[model samples]
Target chain A: MERKVVFAKPEALTDAPTHYCPGCTHGVVHRLIAEVIDKLGIREITIGIAPVGCAVLAYNYFNLDVAEAAHGRAPAMATGLKRVQPDKVVFTYQGDGDLAAIGTAEIVHAASRGENITTIFINNAVYGMTGGQMAPTTLPGQVTTSTPFGRDVKIAGYPLRVAELIATTSGAAYVVRRMVTKPATIASAKKAIKLAFQAQRAELGFSLVEILSSCPTNWGLNPREALEWVEENMAAYYPLGDYKVIDEVKSLK
Target chain B: MAKILMKGNEAIAEAAIRAGCQAYFGYPITPQTELLEYMSRRMVELGRVFLQAESELSAINMVYGAACAGARVMTSTSSPGFSLMQEGISYIVCSEVPAVVINVMRGGPGLGNIQPAQGDYFQMTKGGGHGDYNVIVLAPTTLQEAIDLTILAFDLADKYRSLVTIIADGMIGQIMEPVELPEIEPPQRPEQPWALTGAKGREKNIITSLYLGGLPLEKVNLRLQETLEEIKGNEVRYAEYMLEGAEIVVVAYGTAGRIAQTAIKEAREEGIPAGLFRPITMFPFPYDRLDEVAKGVEHLLVFELNAGQMLEDVHLATRDRLPIHFYGKMGGVVPSPAEVLAEIEKIASPQRGER
Candidate 1:
């Protein structure tokens, strides 16, 4: 008997290297998403939406057909694409600034409507793309370029807990928050992404996987220090947990 | 197809549904609010998506979403709301998403009036949004034409894979007229292999308009320019009345065109050889026919509900061959047929210096 080989390169487009700074977990999350599409054998039919913040250039790295949405409007655009082409896999990669701030209404309505699309929300606790601005997910005491004197709760208010808020909505089928600072966390992040895509494929409604990513350049930390910083400062504020898992809940319902 | 009396707004809404528009997203603005009211009552019974969005911005985005999903989606707004929607409209154009936008224009540079105006002519034709792009604009003169052109707008949108705007005014949206609804057929939608439903077993297709490289972006622009040229060549439409042997021609569109038609009738009855030229496709401007009319006529009168917006195009078409007289009513006022007829008579009278 003769053995035949059937291995090939990932179908994602081979574009320029990502524009994320060193130690930024956006690259890791991107690789993991690419791997999920490859593993699920859906790279050829997957469409990713790029938001206006750090992931704005997501079209460059993701080999699939990528649509760049205006700041904070990715969810709405994804809803359009997914509703029209319900057979193709649709996902949105959005940043904390884009998702929780300017696009708040879109996010809330899309979640409430349970639009059958996947959202990959990267919450770095700071606006990475726009030079260390205070984001909606910024930690309470963390100082950004904007919150120079530490986030004064009296004025700036506390950081928003998006996963928790979105999880309360009936439209959200799966909502999880996972950090990507270590290998174990990375493995769990991959699982979350796979399950989110699975929920989308099942037509179970909207799925969101919030990745707690590191922004070393924005955080004013070295690569290794940034990884440690996310593990130390961000993890406590945005605890890693599955807020809602539809497969388990549906079995009960 | 027997004529039935219908409110202009209700007729448009019914015609849109009958034409197989499965989803509608809109924000309420005065003068055109009845459109949304009609959709709200009808869409639920028809099993279609009808959402009164949080804002005009979100409404257009919802239309964008539904269009991307391969549904025949539409949205309606008045002037201020339409202005708010320009961002998403630009995105739809750049992404080549097929959808319909109905701008029942009221007056404004800012909330000008709730009545009627032809002020948005430049905004509709000259790329109201922020981009180097164009939307297929249809100007309907009657409630019947409103229904017919709206259905045609969807077809043109899909055929060209672009956005189409039915640019009417509050008069058309508010007035009652007899219209015959066309027999609605199930739309024969093209295969959207690029749509993002699920990967299933096919290759993932991404629909994007982001081309960073200069060479690739130029190629996209060239292709778009070519598409516009083809649209202009084939889609220019107009109605010419009494131009074969007339001394004066009046140019107008939408509500103003209907007024011009009446003016032409009155002028002829008054022993003045006056004609009317109504442009259906405002973007293409019907320059060829305008030139033809210009050659036979000694004077041209352009009437509008704005500060002589389309008159500029009429002048460009006639190349100043005939002296063009302008009559307009601004701030949501409609130019009456009597007023337009008076302008026609003024232009039709033999010039003091000429034979």
Candidate 2:
């Protein structure tokens, strides 16, 4: 009897094992992006700009032309690459601290300019690579190393709803928020990722997908509990939805 | 092309375009703003890339990206703006991508004034950005030299796969002079195997400044040092005027160098054996040549638009073999030729006798 293979790693991912801690969802998102690249048959024509976070070594995992950017400058770097090579698909992989805090200017301007690039923002509520610390997206009353007694709203402002902020930009064509806590949401996230890339391929303006991801090590929870926490706490604040879908992007097949 | 009267800033832009600079990203800053304005129109007309970035920080990173894609890229800024770009510049240098940067300097320790000054000497030549790296700095004295050096900047950047900076002041950036612009055909860029032009039919390339391990980072620093050593050996540039029988050598660069020429000529006619040593390359400074000049001359006078910034380099080069005199006007003051001549005369006078 002959058996058909149903599960295998995407070709877009290299054979190297990731350095992410156990239960971290960075691997899941990386695989999803690889799968999308494989489905689109664009691995050869894709360039990835990795941020200065846990995914700083993303170049090692993705089998594509990759460039590592200075902290919070990935969007600007992606714009540079895409402007010169419009035929190639360029994307940036950034974490919450990189996108929402230090790199806020770069991301905001990139969206305003309507630069034709895709961004995959991982909103994990804490700075992962440098150990757990309060990030721009850290929820109110959430405790991290820096916010030892839980974040105080009076001292630390409310968490930034990045997707909503990006949606308000006139130049943004597609902006969405999704979580990978369950298989259904994972599928929706992959769909959103594909649409963002599609928007770029169709010459639409900037597109971004903000993924509400998990950081078990930083959150001090098991991988299973982290998913439940994201489902219960993060999803409430950063509700999953299509925040911005311009007419041009919505019309894309 | 025939000699056309062009502002120094505009000529630098034209020369860069002629040299096949494919992309230009910059922000609006005084003095250097004209360069970005000129590119905004000309680059679009010529079907090249032009982007008015949000800030110098964004502009430098954009140039970094375009450069990583194997495109000839450039950016221009002033002192404070250049200060903001230090991080991106450090990353670009470590990544070893070819890029051109034009710094039309202004008075500054902190937003001092918009007038011309060379206070960035220590920053430009001594690695303004953090890390063990060096950028090739070219100081052009005249508009014609600005044009010529702007073109040379592209070639040198590409040749060394390093950042080449054109350090001018508001004097050179805002002044006007007739220049014969070179007509260069579009460059046929050699294939860069390391460039991140998608990995079509090849293994993917990674351009990064991050080396987590000690040995790997050390290797990167060692390699950068080796490249700098090569640049020092091959790219040191300076010019001498009336040094045939000179006893007193006035060392300057950019506007200071241009002004010193007049003073030297006036001193020459008055029987004072004064000559000018103008450095074209600020980095890989003419240390050896200055030492050679020291061997022939009795006194060395360093003049600049800043408070003796280059005097430190002059001191290092001469190694205290002879007395080094410094005359500088800080906070955007451009001393007249007569003022410099007076300084030269004071040094030349038998009464002020050999300090």
Candidate 3:
């Protein structure tokens, strides 16, 4: 049998030029969503909710039907659209500040309610669109525009562990954290996205894939150094692993 | 169609279901909580989506999401919750997505009393959310009109690709009255050949509100203004009662209109030529008709549950044209017909006596 080309375009994203800064991992993540949609053969029935922030214009970049949601409300919006049109594959693409901050309640309850939608959470540990302010996921001792004196754990409290906290929610059918900095990690990230879309298609409950990405422009580092910085500083706070899988728990129960 | 006695809140919920609204997202707020409770129990049985969101903000956004996918979706809340939802509401308006929001008016600058108050008149009729956008607002006085207008709200929303609001007070939401239930019909949604569900056999569709530059964004705003102007021209609705040969016309809406009706009856009995003008559409406010009535009427009394919100509109509609009298009760206090008649008597008395 002839080997087919696996690294082809996914129909989920449009072929238009992306507006992300050079070396930003957002472009890679976009490609991963497209690849997953193409692989699952559900690109035709997928509705993506774009969040306010850096990805506000994602509708133009994504070749699929994409709707822009208010800052931090992508998950809630996706929940509404998915429930109304159950047959449609709905997902929300959100950033750290939008998701872990303003949208905290929406994210928690959508997961708690077991909304049958997918969430692609891009955790860059800083507010990229707002000019690199410290984020909920910002690591201790890491300096950001708001935390110029370094993030004091005592003053700011410990960084939020969103994936770990959400894993404890029984409504979440699947929860995982993956990095997109390296080739192998990229493959795993792609696989995770595929699983999320598949779970949505199977009528499974809520699924969240937290992607560890780099905002080199905001991190005060060169493109190469930012990738390395994420691996060294961010990885410790946002650990990479499958925090929970509902099917496994269901079988045990 | 059969008429049955139902509470206003329950009537709105039943009307939503009958309008083929397949999803409802809401958080509990007094006066409007019954609407959510009714949907929670009925939606599942009807195979619709019902979710009690963690907050009003999320609930409205959930409605936004469902609407973007071409689903008829809605949420209900009182004043305070509606405040939290302003950001999301702005997004819905800017994005041109269709959804319905029910505001059961309550007194407030903060979490004021939960009793009926029409304090949200300015917020609902004027631009509540940030941006140059207007939502089609419908105010229903009776339970039957509540159900009928709720259905009409969805139709207007879909037809204009805009958000629609059914603005009523706590009194309307809590009161019981006879309502004729209409058959639920699915809205004629334009084939969003552009919605992103997946790429199967169709080209990818992108729905967004982002305009990168000034020129493109201005064009979007211009289009929105055009649509609003068209709506203003065609959708203004009101009811005129005994205004043809009346001297004083009482202007009101929702439950206040009901009280005004009673006040009109008493005023007529007392040999005063008083009538009522109840506005059903508060946004495309029955300004033209009110202006027409203002030409012949000597005094226009605006009765409201708020301190004096709707009075502003009444003043605008009749300013320079006639004299407009304002009477209101705040902090969830509902004015009695006697109280309103008293104000009318003061305004109509030949010799203006000292206060």
Candidate 4:
């Protein structure tokens, strides 16, 4: 039997080595986005805005024209870029800390305005870039740098459900929450990514797909356990399902 | 084109259109709300990009996005609102994106007042945001000057690839005057190899101000400093009135400068030799021209709406050789032309008035 190459690097992804920690899912998330852009034939005309957190170096990975936005301002930047060059496809890759906490105002307003853009929100539940600090998505009773005593719900508010909140906004044409830690969920995450891009291409308004990723180093667990943690804890709070989808997007093949 | 009587804010809006501005992002603040309102419609009708951002922070970042996309962009705001834009402005400065920001100044320190004030003189001329970067600031006294400078701002922005600010006061923003709009010649843009306009058939472009490691960041900083020095050497602008032979000079700009002109005429007719020095570009503060104006003058009276901010620059320019005085009215109070003359008369009095 002859073994041919079953896997190859996506041409849309740059050759630059990612600086993510061992077993971190940021690499997988990046690859999925690049794959979606390539499959849609938009890699030549796509512009991406990288957030200020761990994925701040996302520009180095994507071969498309990319710019780094301020900590939580990627959505606002995307609004401007998309509106200016309506013919080009624009998107932003933001992390939990960048999108939910510091940039809530930007994301809410951009979606409310029905901006023609796409956003990839990574919800790992902790601030991975800053050594595992408490994030808006931090689960109840989860310990972090700022919450050494196992996150007190009274002192620190409950975790924010970004997908649910944005789904309520009239402008969000497609909103979904998915996990990429398991092989089965990873396939669904890729499909969600594809559908989100399809929504943007159809000019159905704002679209977003929140992916629950693993940060083994920050979680103090091995790579395998980290995936299980996302599967058990994170998926429970942020359930995997479609939160919002417009009629036209739902009718897509 | 035809000379049209219009409000100062409206003229600035029309002028930006004539200058081939492709995008406008702004949040509504007093004094500049008209500018935003005008753009909200005109930009759409002209098939351009317009967005009323959620806040000043979003508005300025939007400008950053458009500039990164290689489009002519601008934003306008008032005092308190302008403060919120400092973070984004600092990023633009560090990234060296060419943009125009119009500051229709109002009272300061807090919500302040909506009335006309020059409290932002230092903020506009100096580096208001973090880092060692300066914005090219132009103070326009009249509606026509606002129209002219608004167009010039785009050229100077593209030429230097830096942020250029047109600093007007609430009066200039609200006042009505006849202005001849600059002819609409598609704006001149310089070569931008750093713009993030998709790869298409070219190499990928990244627009970021981040430079990790010491030596690399230092190299970028040193290059930016060199550009600033070049700007200082070439772009110094000012105007003089009755400086041929004078014993007293009133240094002012924007609305204060226009007020000083009246005071200079009255002082001259009252047998006191008085002249005016109006700085068109406040960053490169026209110090050399101020030295020339200070040659025969015994007193330099710097009048403003704030507390003696520009006087510091006057002292530096005159090298403290001549006696420099300051007369300011804070809290949104504009000094009358008579009040400026009275200060000048006090200088000319026998007692030299309380020094």
lDDT of 2 by residue, B91-147 (tens): 999999999999999998898899999999988999999998889999999999999
User: What digit string (tens of lDDT, one per residue) describes model 3 on residues B1-355?
Assistant: 6779998899999999999888999999999999999999999998888998889988888888877777788999999999888888888888887889999989887999899998888888887989888889999999989998999998898888889998988999999988899875566666655444555676666666778889988999999999999999999999988776789999999999999999889988888899999999998898778888889889998888987887877777777577777888888999799988888888889464235
The C-alpha lDDT values of all candidates are: 0.85, 0.94, 0.86, 0.90
Task: Provide the global lDDT of candidate 1 against the true structure.
Answer: 0.85
Off by over 4 Å in 2: A1-3, B350-355
Where is the poorest 10-residue window by lDDT in model 2 chain B? B346-355
True contacts kept of each: 0.57, 0.84, 0.94, 0.74
Please tell me which model should have the higher TM-score, number 2 or number 3. Answer: 2
Q: Which candidate has the highest DockQ of all?
A: 2
Scored by lDDT, model 2 comes in at 0.94
Q: What is the TM-score of chain A alone in each candidate?
A: 0.93, 0.98, 0.94, 0.97
Residue-wise C-alpha lDDT for candidate 4, range B150-181, written one tens digit per residue = 99999988888889999898999999998887
Give per-residue CA lDDT, model 3, range A61-141, as digits (tens): 877777888888888888877876788888899998899988888898888888889999999988998898989988898
TM-score of chain B of 3: 0.96
Clashes of each: 22, 0, 20, 0
Give each prediction's root-mean-square deviation over alpha carbons: 3.8, 1.4, 2.5, 1.6
Report the number of backbone clashes for model 1. Answer: 22
Residue-level lDDT of model 2, residues A29-89, one tens digit each, is: 9999999999999999999999988999999999999999999999999989999999999
The DockQ-based order of candidates, best leading, equals: 2, 4, 3, 1
- By TM-score, who's the top model here? 2
